[model samples]
Target: MKTFVKIMLAATIVLVAGLWFSNSFKALNNQADALEQPTEVIEQPIIEKTKIEPVKKTPFSETIVVETAIKFEAPLYWAVNDYGLIDGYSSTEELIEKYYLEFTEEQLARLFTEDFFYNEADGVHVTASASPNLIQTDRDFTITELNENQYQVSQVLYTLDDGETAYIFVDYIYDEVNNNWNIAMINYQY
Candidate 1:
């Protein structure tokens, strides 16, 4: 009776293991079949290309041609008094000889206008320093034409070792009689 009981217990365990293995195998096969099945593909929409037209010009539109000339820079200079200080220039003649050599007669006359200087008799008075030092060697200047008879001259002056900048703006008007550029106005950046 004892041997029969032991054999019955071992048989029950083997039967349970066989059923579990069979169920696991069936589940694995079902998963494989789901992956192997065919799927429906969706189609993409087609796009059409459009042609571009060139822009047309109207008869009222007129293109003006501008002629740009080479830009020339006037040399940087200091206005010093008779004692070699930056107080006031010695005389109008000295000022003209040093700085206004390129200026036309009309331009020179414009310099004496009542609004041009603080002291007309003294000419240019710069009481800032004894003398201006050149901070950089290269400088840039531009002259643009506002119209056929007028031009604008602009220059940037970097002076002294302290990196100071002085801007000079001058307007030149073309004299039909002389056919040359004449200074109409002169301003400093301060």
Candidate 2:
């Protein structure tokens, strides 16, 4: 009786495992069959295509215009006293203080060559001189390229007090060592 009971218990466990495996296998087979089946194709409505015309090609010409204005960075004038005399000072600081000029010594120095200012028998004087108030109303500038590093700018100036018209030419030369352009010379013609 004991042997028979043990055999029955083993058989019941085997039967339950077999049923579980059979159900799992059947579910996997059903999924594979569904994947192998072809998908449904829905019909789409067709519309007529419109014809596109070819664009006509035209000859194109590109024109470029460039305008540049040259500016004088420093004042090109000599300091004068109340008595209408060219005032000479011992140093730039003294000249600025006496004339109430806006330029610093360094800025004034940059406007000319290294030896622009020198002491004479009477007093210190500059090589180039012009008054800003004398510049004409038109202020038209004619720029000429002298060389690769030199440029000459010519303009007409008018004096209000004397009613004088003069043509002023300023030459600028590029300083290679300093990598800047400095006023090399200035000339005037009536």
Candidate 3:
């Protein structure tokens, strides 16, 4: 009789636990439904507006695209090869690259810009008994390098094609937006 009573008690406990779990699950379901179905937000409206303007458009055929070919983007330059090196070996190549990257054609013109510095040391003399003509000397200079601090160049006064050459130096200032080197002053002609 005692064994029967113990079995009955165990069965009752199991049934009660199952019922409680089912009712708890139902209560959770009720909460989810109540949260999902909102009690407000009755209506919304639809409206439209359009505005137009006129402008001239150029034809695609006539459009020209000019892209600057920066062989090396500086700092960590030549990291990803955008411009292929033809033979991959250049000694004077660096100087040539500097000219394109550091100076514009317009900036190059400024080197030849004529304005007397008035300060005797900075001005030029055309005729001197012991010296070569400064005008002819300048005409001989060919652009070799454009740098953030200086312009490295060559001056060949005697021979146009094959002459004794001297490096012409121009002082420079660096431009940030253009990332360019500009002539600040022609400090030395060496």
**Best model number under lDDT:** 2
Higher-lDDT candidate of 1 and 3: 1
Model 3 misplaced stretches (Cα beyond 4 Å):
1-34, 38-138, 146-150, 154-168
Which lDDT value does model 3 have at 68? 17
Q: Candidates' TM-scores?
A: 0.31, 0.32, 0.22
Worst 10 residues of 2 by lDDT: 59-68
lDDT of 1 at 143: 57
Instruction: Per model, state how many residue pairs clash.
Output: 0, 0, 0
- How accurate locally is residue 74 in candidate 2, as Cα lDDT from 0 to 100? 28
Residue runs of model 1 more than 4 Å from their true location after superposition:
1-102, 105-138, 159-165
How would you encode candidate 3's per-residue C-alpha lDDT over 126-186 as one tens digit per residue? 1212322231321434443353334443344343345544443434444555554433443
lDDT values for all models: 0.49, 0.51, 0.39
Clashing residue pairs, backbone N/CA/C < 3 A, model 1: none
Backbone steric clashes in candidate 3, count: 0
Scored by TM-score, the top model is 2
Cα miss at 100, model 2 (Å)? Answer: 16
